[model samples]
Target: MPQDFVKIAQRGELMPGKMKRVDLDGRRILLANVDGSYYATDDTCTHEESSLSKGFLKGDTVKCPLHGSRFNLRTGQVLDDPAEENLRTYPVRLDGDDILICLT
Candidate 1:
């Protein structure tokens, strides 16, 4: 069963072009605000197990600091080489002034 979407943070907490790491029921999630929408994905880079939240954010993409792997924040797809798997993405929604992440 899919877990209900939980409020991770306030909308104002994560600014555009910034990434924040949050623990969702023991799962590490990368919460990013691109433009004005919020997105949630696995915090760890698939290829190197590095923290994607600690990486640099360029527009809607995040560059992995370990191997320079770039991932699309919206879809969690690897846009560059060296990453063999797509990042795990979670459903996100805005609830009032809070950002809700679905952990299914």
Candidate 2:
């Protein structure tokens, strides 16, 4: 694993179609599992700064619970209204049973 990438969870810790929030280095990161594939993104919504993990996750789109803002977990693109800016995405790497997230 790279020095910038740190293990956030185990492979079995998160099930498919579920999401979790990881607080590391004072930053909140949203980790999602979709069909065994993992993706990481900023937990804060671009519109209202609400935690995205508290919202809804359907497919790869995560909807903000506060203002209905939706963002793509894969590419960090905004997909719905009420959000003009896109969320920041992180690279997720799987090493054995470890789920690692890139900080840079």
Best by TM-score: 2
How far residue 15's Cα lies from its native spot in candidate 1, in Å, is: 1.0
lDDT of 2 at 22: 92
Write the residue-wise lDDT of candidate 2 on 1-104 in tens digits.
Answer: 54588999998989999999999988999999988999999999989869999999999999999989899999999998889999999888998999998888
Pairs clashing in candidate 2? none
Worst 10 residues of 1 by lDDT: 1-10
Tens-digit per-residue lDDT, 1-104, candidate 1: 65798899998898887889998799899999889988899999999879988899998898888998999988889999788788999998887998898887
Best by lDDT: 2
Model 2: C-alpha RMSD to truth?
Answer: 1.6
TM for candidate 2 is 0.95
CA lDDT of each prediction against the hidden true structure: 0.89, 0.92
Per-candidate clashes come to: 0, 0
